[model samples]
Target: MAGTSTGVLMAELTTTARATRVIAAVVGVALLLAGTVWGQDDKFPFGPFSMYAGVNGPNEPAPDTRVEGTDSTGRVIVLAERNAGVRRAEIEGQEGAYVDDPSRLARIADSYQRLNPGAPPLVKVALIVREHEIHNSSATGRWWDDVRAVWDRPA
Candidate 1:
């Protein structure tokens, strides 16, 4: 008798698990549809997959940007390495903000010098973004860089 009861319980548990999976799948499909039909402005809690279009194929140019700094002695340094833990994406997204108010860049420079006491004093900081063209995804092509932003310390 006990064996029979345990068997019934196991069957019920299996059925419940199947139902949960179906419900989860349905909910996922609904979210995908809503995200696509509504708008790409983050209607859902997460996102609509900004770059769902996939890569730029085998031949294209990708963006590569970083901050370069000039030390007090005229030595070049990568400001991104000592940017007070700010990532490249965050800074790039805030490009307009930085351009509007360059004082923020100054604060970041100060943070870099403070964190790396042994490093030389940073006098100028420039954000450079480069575009590198790729050929057949196997070889790199022509590349060009642009100076997006530049900041210097007070005399």
Candidate 2:
């Protein structure tokens, strides 16, 4: 009798485990299908997180970017010259969202003001992006300069 009861309990446990696995698999399938069916920005399991996927996307050569400003005396002050605690990649990431916004330039100017207490105020600020053709890792040909965003604020 004891052996029979133990056997029955083991069978029950196996069935429960199988059922749980089946339910989980069903839910997983449902989620996968749902992701494929949803319209835009919802395809996660089967979609790319990048904006574009092609040779022109991320495979293109990376350009140099700078947050430059014209001081009150019309001198160009690059962010690196001020020794601001900022990185090029940080500005690169922000360029996507702040490229068309003027406040972003203003914010950079403010940061520069904080960094240089004795320097003259900035007359205009701009986020400049320069794209150069990839001609080896050391040297490149003439590139294009594009003013992605700018703000003119008088001190």
Candidate 3:
């Protein structure tokens, strides 16, 4: 009788495990389908596969974004990951938001100050975009900076 009960319990557990796996797989597939249909960069992981989905036309300029600051001594500083503790990709991803409200850049300035205590305090921060001139889908070694937004430190 004991042996029969143990065998029955094992069979029941196996059935439950199989059902759980099937349910999980179905949910995963549903999320993938939904994300593919209606996801953007913000909805990453399951989002649309769009990092390289779009192609640029030959002879069109390619945008390169960077963050820069004007210090108290009037020296320009590039705020890269090492100095500012923020990555360029993070800034580029939210370029539109910064353009809409330049004041948001103050956070970056604060971060820069926190990381580099001896450096001159930033007087101004700006989001600049350099469009690299391209020809035949190749870089022409020419570019121009377009200042999208500037945030001046308050007195």
Worst 10 residues of 1 by lDDT: 44-53
Across 27-134, the per-residue lDDT of candidate 1 in tens digits comes to 988887777767453354433544344577677777777877788889887766445555675566677787777667776687788888888888888777788888
Writing each residue's lDDT as its tens digit, candidate 3 over 56-115 gives: 799989988999999999999999999998877678878999999999999999999999
lDDT tens digits, residues 40-70, model 2?
A: 3335564332333334333356567988888
Candidate lDDT scores, in order, read: 0.72, 0.70, 0.89
What is the TM-score (0 to 1) of candidate 1? 0.59
What TM-score, over all chains together, does every model reach?
A: 0.59, 0.55, 0.71
Off by over 4 Å in 2: 1-61, 135-140
C-alpha RMSD (angstroms) for model 3? 6.4
Ranking by lDDT: 3, 1, 2
Score candidate 3 by TM-score against the native: 0.71
**Model 3 per-residue lDDT at 30:** 89
Task: Give me the candidate number with maximum TM-score.
Answer: 3
Compute the lDDT for candidate 3. Answer: 0.89
After the best TM-score superposition of candidate 2, give how far the Cα of residue 12 lies from its true spot, in angstroms.
Answer: 46
